[model samples]
Target: MLKSFDNKALEELNDSNASENERAKKGLKKRSDFGYAVLFLGPSLLLLGVFVFYPMIKTLYMSLFLTNNFGQTTIFVGLKNYTSLLTSASFLASLSSTFIYVIGVMVLTIVLGLALAVFANQKLKGIQFFRTIFSSTMGVSVSVAAIFFLFVFNPTTGLLNQMAGLLHLPQLNWMTDPNLAMITVIVSTVWMNLGFTFLVLFGALQAVPRSLYDAADIEGASKSYQLFKITIPMISPSLFFVGIVTLIGAFKSFGLIDLMTAGGPNNATNLLVYRIYQDAFLNGNYSQASTESIVLTIIIAVMTIIQFKVLEKRVNY
Candidate 1:
């Protein structure tokens, strides 16, 4: 009887093994389909690797050596480039300018964006027209905006100076002065970027559930209270996103500075990115430029990590 039972169990096991083999065959066919899918994506992957990764690696390698007029020579100067970058007074001055520029742009953009979004969200007549006018700046290229502002703020014949003269106010040098040049750049950047931030925040605001507002009203919560307790928290994720984008844009800003100030007024408006451009192309200090590039990359990466770890945690969703 035991031998008969054992034979019966072995027959059941064989049946299960046959079923597994059939499933494995199906899986193999699925994997072949996936391989074909990957094959279709091969060209895009190759292009990205060649254009992005290869150049990135080459730039990193170029940062470590000294190149002269004779030919390319890899001297492996170790941390000399980094050391010089850190110790240089000009670099330190530019670093401070960059920090100021980043802070100014971020603050102004977020404040203006939040205000504009809140205003646009209101049930006003011709709201679409207002939004279009406000957001129109986003489509303007940075170079064009820079040039436009350059003309508009010209000390002699500019619109702003003429208006100030009409008002009997002192004519201010908007772009030539070191202090005012940076401010002009910051304001221009804020205006250019505010549209996207406004759209993002406005969408986030619209997405909040109406039921929550109704519940708040039922609970005798004031509009201001509800806004602080409900609307802001609900919109925190969008604000966080806008904040990071604005910060990164501020850091990488080169066009406005290049076109407007050229990091002028004794390097008072010189940002790290502009400095990198000057070093790489104008001065031909490729190694030093690479070093600055790496440092800037690390700074941006750290800020991003901090945003995720700290600020993102406070977001309701």
Candidate 2:
């Protein structure tokens, strides 16, 4: 027994040494591969450092000093730029409209997209064609979508007004009216984003195990019951993903706001991103624009964190 125990201990010691030697070999191999790794990754890192990191650092630096139209430093205002934006009525209005537009777009886009995705997921005849049509907007560019909607919302020969005339309904100012302009842009944005949202949710729907629905059917569950209970819970992950994406996308919305209302009849549709552009290029207040850019970044980060904390618990997977 003593001899057997001694042999067993020696075997364990040998195994440990062998494992350590293998690890050391791996470490040496990794050191030798370091040059190759750097060769492959160096160019990409250099590009990002120049284009992405430098600009970000520059924006932060510029936020501290007021810059002229030529981007030359005019004054070092430190926190004053931030405090001024907090009190400016125009800034406040822009903030308010930004929230309204974001919420409107997120809600409408998700709801409409999910609905369309569910319908397209049905196994009816020609469903493939319908699915293609539903997601066709994904191919449309933002500029083109905005311009197309421009013609559709035009006053005299616009499709909406033309239909209204035929129905004897009053012509509505979709763009000029302060109250309606925000809603109109929201509608167009939702339409533009619907295809992507639909595709995401549809893919999720398709991935759902059919066995769950089969069990629900066997138990005599109603269609609505299966949808609300089984289908929704099964797809909660996709819903959560879409919620985050749409929320961020809506916050970053600029093209629609610019091409449609140019940030408004009364600055009613002035979102933060567009406001940033206005300050930097048109107003030539680079400092204020940089400050707003920082604020927008913080806003997006904070809201995304909040959304994660609040919604993550409900995501089934």
Candidate 3:
């Protein structure tokens, strides 16, 4: 009887497996299943091809030629435009400024965002209000923030100098002084980006299981120790996301530099994006501008690759 029962159970399992296989085969025959997918993805692919891919290819092709002041390609200069950019003083200065701006924004935004996220994650009354206030900076557009900072950092009638004067501190140039212009821009960019970073990290922090914290507490781990070991590792994915986004935003910053300094005080704040604008729009050096843009794109791509390679090792899956 036991042998008969075992054979019956095996037969039932085989029947179930056969049914599943039959269903899977029927599903494979359903070509209409992917129709909705293609329908959904078709528009996006078309848009990307038209806008992003086509422009990228055009820019690369345009970079090979020297353009006249009217933005027309006047000569087939080959790689001379790129070589000139490498050797140009203003281009070099802008490249240096770009690195500085990107790094400053990345470091400041991540550090401040993490700190704020940690604080905002606390179980306290009216915490939502604090979170909202902290993330409010994201609402301010780059142009608006630049305009606001323009007044804030004004030497005579500005809030910064006024406050310094009230405090009996010596007034210093903010945007006018070459040394401080990039720093001022960095500050503004960091502030503008902090809100999104904070929001991402805060959400990541909330997703961390409370049981992990409890376990850490039971292990007698200090808050700092727990934070470093558990919190950071767990939220590393979010941190990585914020880092990449901030880096890209910093590299593409145009409005702040345009409004605040206009690459002023002798091109002190002329970041790569602004320099590209200067070349393409202001100087009408379309070929050279395209070259600079390509260089900028390469730099961003290399840096992003480096970030993935270096940071991925430390990131907890």
Who wins the lDDT comparison? Answer: 2
Each candidate: what lDDT?
A: 0.82, 0.85, 0.85
Q: Candidate 1, residues 1-317: lDDT per residue as tens digits?
A: 01123334556689988887898988754244667778999889899999978867766776777766332545888777788889999999999999999999998998889888877877788999988877788799998998888888888999999999999999999877889888888988998898788888888888989889889999999978987898778888778778877898789899998998999977889999999999888987788888888888888877666565544255555
User: So what's the TM-score on candidate 3?
Assistant: 0.84
> Candidate 1, which segments miss by more than 4 Å at Cα?
1-29, 33-38, 69-71, 214-224, 306-314
Candidate 1: residue 240 Cα off by (Å) = 0.3
lDDT of 2 by residue, 195-310 (tens): 88899899989998989989989999998998898878888877877877788888899998888999988889989999999999999889999999998988877766655554
Which of candidates 1 and 3 reaches a greater lDDT?
3
Model 3 misplaced stretches (Cα beyond 4 Å): 1-24, 27-43, 303-314
For candidate 1, report its TM-score: 0.84
Error of 1 at 276 (Å): 1.1
lDDT at position 167, candidate 3: 100
Clashes of 2: 0
For TM-score, the strongest prediction is 2
TM-score of each: 0.84, 0.87, 0.84
Q: What RMSD does model 2 have?
A: 10.4
Residue pairs clashing, model 3: none
When superposed on Cα atoms, how far off is each prediction in RMSD?
A: 11.9, 10.4, 10.4
Q: What residue pairs clash in candidate 1, if any at all?
A: none
- Candidate 1, which ten residues in sequence have the lowest lDDT sum? 1-10
Which has the higher lDDT value, candidate number 1 or candidate number 2?
2
